[model samples]
Target: MISQNTIDTVFETARVEEVIGDFVNLKRAGSNFKGLSPFSDERSPSFMVSPVKGIWKDFSTGKGGNSVKFLMEHSQFTYPEAIRYLARKYNIEIEETEQTDAEKAITDVRESMYLVSEFAKKYFHNVLLNTDEGQAIGYSYFKERGFTNETIKKFELGYSPETWDALTKEALGQGYKLEFLQSTGLTIPKEDRPFDRFKGRVMFPIQSMSGRVLGFGGRILTNDKKAAKYLNSPESELYHKSKVLYGIFQAKQSIAKQDNCFLVEGYTDVIQFNQAGIENVVASSGTALTPDQIRLVNRLTKNITVLFDGDAAGLRASIRGIDLILEEGMNVRVCTFPDGDDPDSFARKTPYEDLVKYLEENAKDFIQFKASLLMDEAKNDPIKKADLIRDMVTSISKIPDRIQREIYVQECARIMDISEQVLVSTLAQLIQKDIAEAGKKQKQEQKPFEVHRNQKPKYTGYSGGDPEDPRNGPPEDYPGEPGYPEQQQVEKIDILYHLERKVIEILLLYGDKTEVFEDVFLRNNGEGEIETVTEKKEYKVFQRIYLSLQEDEVELSNTLFRDIFTGLIAFYHQNEKFSLEQYLMRLQPEFAQEVTDILMEDEKVTLHDWEGQNIFSKGKSESISQYVTETIMSMRWFLVDKIIEELKSSIVSNPKEDNMELLMMVMDYSKLINSFSRKLGRVMSRYHT
Candidate 1:
């Protein structure tokens, strides 16, 4: 177990913005920062981080919590692991009591996988740097490709030795299980033997977006004509090639800062570009570009510059990727190397400024590039020329943004010697075809359900029934009444709204208020009523809340009440004058959720965001606080009134007023109602100004 002292230190030192910034490209959005959610594939910025409140919320996923929670959710780290991550990031030393062997044996599977992968990375890196065979093969290969020592180490390039059981044996000797090694694909198991998977090949570690090693890509050096040129780790619990973009872990920050990503085809291309000072570059690792990969880059920047080799096959194979990028609503530009060179060779030959200038001058939009590449083949061949035109139009039609598609269509027409009107008409037909396909797909998705034979059409909760008719659920009794759905709903809404307003009021108005409630005497009890205050229902609620607040407890059991309650807890802890405007500025999503929950529950709420004139008035801190107190007191009085009414009905039914217990209950109910009414009046008068 982690000590309380460690948890507190982690919370105090780990800033939400600092922790999240490592993975996300956050841009200032008003007082908070907003970015694409790392938790989901989104094009727009819906992930919000508030440093003041020390919490983050992904509006798309509805996941919001403090820094520790974000790390746990994003990295799949356990609580202790999250704490350790923050401790390492902030340079805090952790001191823990020794654990027993039995305790150490109980490791989480996810963490175990991470540990095995990390161990493999270190072992491979050690082989490349320190072993003679590794230096002669792996190090020499990287050096021959013009990579400097610093660049090699920065990328953690390595070699796996050519021994059958070298790694498995070493790992087992070091207390790691062979099962975990095989699970991570670090070791290949034969019928009765096991061997290192990447033996005799140079290594490239593939990392997660958060920079943890997940798998590897290995390149074989021998000229065995039948041997494959490159090999990659199989899909494991930690690595999915379809979702992983090589070098993203290193390039994400630069991509965000520059607001662009440079896409290349291979590992060397990524390294060479970075070495040439173009830091925001990643490789697709020879796989066809996927929507998942594009969305990953899209999270950092909307602009992508695809760097391709000058070879014809490479260009033809990559054309499909351009449409995919466009479909994702990304702005893509294509740049090819010289006929004899690729990104790796060209980056080494040209100066950084000259290379950047070359890309800027040569990069063409996808539509124009496709047209220019295919135009020569179609020249003077009417059928082929018409096909080329249709192809360009089809590509243009894939763009999701209408204005962008129109602009591309205009450019395509000019390049292909076709009329803009003709291109536009063709695009319209393609769009209609797409819509029809989509509708057909929707119908196919709905085919599994059995149609109801004699169903009465459902009425939504908004359809208010006749109030005078018992047939429509007993006249829809108001809140605090017996046997009414609306009454329970109203009670819930009143409690939430009032509690929030009271907390906010305490935070904004009386943050520094030191007024204490004095002990009051009770004539019937002889002793002062204050001594028995601990047992009173209202006082018990206050006491529970007060102790929780003092313990730095912030999370409210009710999701609807959490944000306001948390804000109140923070306010008490800060010891500074609180500002409602600033608080709202920071936690807009939480506040919005709370407001929506309240409004959606009750058919009639006492206070809206505005007053009777539809003007913004009651939402002010003072007005809201007064309204909350009124609502709570009114609810209490209403409950007492219902009790009194029930007792009177019982007495009338009996005809003889001889029930002493019933008489006491009625008196108590009346006294409570009168007290609550007086308190409600005083609270209203307090806000009458």
Candidate 2:
């Protein structure tokens, strides 16, 4: 367990913007910072970080929290792992409570795999830089490829020794588990014994976006016919080849700053371009580009320029990826090197200025590239040219943004010297066909399950009818028919979600403010009938909200929200002043995100000028007492309404005399609901005017 003192120190020292900036590129948006969401693919910035609150919210994914929660969500770290990571980053001394042996035994498997990979990376790198065989073979190989010493070390280039069991034996000697080693693909297990997977190959470490070493890519030095030339780490929990980009850890900052990314095809291509002073580049690690990889780039920038080799095969490879990028709603530009060269060779042969100038001068819009490439093959043949136009339309249809698709169509029309109408019509047909195919595929994937009545068990002497009988269902006296209870439960959950959230929001924002509230009571003044009395009572925001819910014996329906509410009430009982920062620090990551979202929702709304658009005319803090009372009343009214509906359903379904009592209860609840509804309406009416 992390000590509370250490957690406090970490929160005080750690800056929200600084921690999130390590992974996302945030720019100042007034008092806050805004960036594209690292959790989702989006063009506009929806991720906001507030230094004052020490919290961040990604509106795209609805995940928000303090700095520690951000790390946990983005890095998939456990709570303790996230705390330790923040402690290290902020240089805070961690005073931890000692755990038992059993507690320590349940350490996270993923973190262990991470540890083994980190050790393997260091071992391979040390071997390359210090050992004679590694210096001679690995160091020499990198130098031969025009990579300077600084570039090699910057990328953490390494070499595995030629001996089969060198890494495996060293890891076991160091107390590292063989299970972790095999899981990371650092050591391959055989029937007899385990051996190093990358023996005799120069290694390239594959890192996560946060720069943790997940796995390695190794290049075989020998020209043996049976062995593959290049091999990557097998898919593991730590390394997913399709979801990762080669230089994302190095290039994410530059990609965000430049608002563009250069897509390439190999590890060397990325390193070479960075060495040539073009920093915002990532490679697909020699696989077909995937939507996951595209989303990774989309988090940093909305524009991508794919660099293709001038050769025929590279051109074909580039064409296959263009549609995927377009479908993601990114602006894609295509740049080709001189026909004989790839990005690696070209970057090596040219000076920095010449290389940069070449890309700037030659990068063409994807539509233009497609038209130019295919026009040559079509060559004035009317039939072939028509087919080429249809092909272009197919690519256009893949685009999710209609405006971009239209612009591409117009460009194609101008280039092909054809009417825009024809191209537009063709694109429409292709889009409709795509939608139909998608719907068909969804239906095929979701086959309905057939439930047989004979499979159900029959219960004896139950008030409700037999389980297997379709018509005899629940007894008439039970809660309305079969589906009514489920429908009512769904309605209650949906209603309570927003209502409970509103109450929580009120307490979080203005919980410490003291306000005057009107309380109604009944008193007898030496008379037969009791006289109604209205008394003014002063209470803190938190006290009023807590008492209102307590008075009704109400608890939130959602487990996470209810837990947060219970914690808030407990804290209010102890502390006179509520501190959001301190509260967030003590919160568990799962619930902390929920609190952060509630706290940051208003800030984001204000930042985007949505608050001033007459959408929510009543400010939450304008009339504190009224706001709290209305919110609590709204929830009470909703709950009462739900009860009335359930009681009415029962009264109609059950002919028993017990229903007379239920009908009276429903009548009283309806009267209370009406009174509350009218008061809420009056409050809303004040806002509208």
Query: Judged by TM-score, which candidate is best?
Result: 2
lDDT of 2: 0.82
lDDT of 1: 0.71
lDDT of 2 by residue, 221-329 (tens): 9998788888999999888999999998889767865779999999999999999999999999898999999999988779999999988655755687889998887
Most accurate candidate by lDDT: 2
Which ten-residue region of model 1 has the weakest summed lDDT? Answer: 600-609
Candidate 2 lDDT trough over 10 residues, lowest sum: 456-465
Return the lDDT, model 1, position 65.
Answer: 70
Return the clash pairs for model 1, or none.
none
Go through the candidates in order and give each one's C-alpha lDDT. Answer: 0.71, 0.82
Candidate 1 lDDT, 1-689, residue by residue in tens: 56657666777777889999998899875556778888666687777777766666776766667666677566656557788889899988776656676765554555687898888888888999999999888899998999999998888988888887888888889889888899889888887888888888899999877778989999999987876788999998888898999998778867865778999989999999999999889999999999999998987778999988889766876888988998888899888888989999999999999998999999987776787788767778999999988888888888876768878887877787678998889999998898788896755754542234232111112222232222222122223234434545445445554654455444444344432231222234554221212121222223334553454333333444566666555655663555533443344343544432332222112122223556543433445445444644554455557568668767876976687889888886676666666667877897676
